[model samples]
Target: MPSLELDRYLGTWYQLAAVPQFFNLVCARDTMATYALDPQGNVSVRNRCTTWMGTPNEISGTATVNDRVTGAQLHVSFPGVPTQESLEGPTNYIVTALGDDYSWALVTDPSRLSGFVLSRTPALNEAQWQQIRTAIEAAGQSQCMYLTSPTTGGLSGIAPLCTV
Candidate 1:
């Protein structure tokens, strides 16, 4: 894992695709996440999305560095969200892959059970999508498990990666 620069990674990232999760089931489109530096030297996480009911759904949490050496591994927790994601507690949030320019990233846990494809923009070109798939495969994950996150704006009405 490459050492993640928290400073460069701090910003809003559009969710291009993600492995299904109960917490995000409420989201129908326009899913995004923002990160910022917190006073305690940790990171603050704010995830937002458009609900199926046409309303907004958001969650705020904290992400603590789990692997200081790499700064690629973290544990994020939101209020009322499940914490049983790991035996050591806290939901594992790892930056398995990242673009050098910090324009895109692939986030997952140690188990690779849940994964997210995040980008600076809501849409990605074919080459970018292919590169993301390659990165996911290198991380030992099947791209077939991912579903394209629908967006009302941006590129709009894109087919899921699973079909590609």
Candidate 2:
């Protein structure tokens, strides 16, 4: 399968939804992600959020493109924490799909075991969401496990999976 193109992939992206991950557990509102080139030429990640009770939190990290042949693959770690405090295992971040206008993206991991749907806007239309769902399934991931993005009212309703 083709990997995500790096240059075209850099920019601010809104988190549409994702599986529950440790790093994001405390994030309760308006979560978003931004990617940029660092001084050393690595991908920089900025994740921001608001607590459930309305406190703001932010984290910054740097990611290295694992395979230039497939720039879609990356290994990321937070800069705020010491290397010893980094994740015990490397997190695989793979880009499975990209929007035609670079307005949205579908990201899965190496095993297609976990993933997220992101966009430039807080909400996505049925068509765009369906496209993400299709890509997730085709990649062998479980769409049923996808939780709702808090961007849409703080996760009150169940996240409906797209049916073919």
Candidate 1 per-residue lDDT, tens place, 1-164, comes to: 65988899999999988898898989889999999989988888899999989999998888888887999898887777666323235448999998767888999999999999999987777878888999999989988888888875554543556685
Alpha-carbon shift of residue 98 in model 1 (angstroms): 0.9
Off by over 4 Å in 2: 1-3, 80-91, 152-164
Model 1 ranges with Cα > 4 A deviation: 84-91, 155-159
lDDT tens string, model 2, 1-164? 37666777888887877876777778776888889998888888888987777898898887887767868777878756655135334547878887777777888887776778888888777777778888877888778777777675334443645422
The weakest ten consecutive residues by lDDT in model 1 span 82-91
Task: Return the TM-score for candidate 2, rounded to 2 decimals.
Answer: 0.84
lDDT of 1: 0.84
Number of the top candidate by lDDT? 1
Backbone clashes in model 2: 0
- Work out the TM-score per prediction: 0.91, 0.84
Output candidate 1 Cα RMSD.
2.3
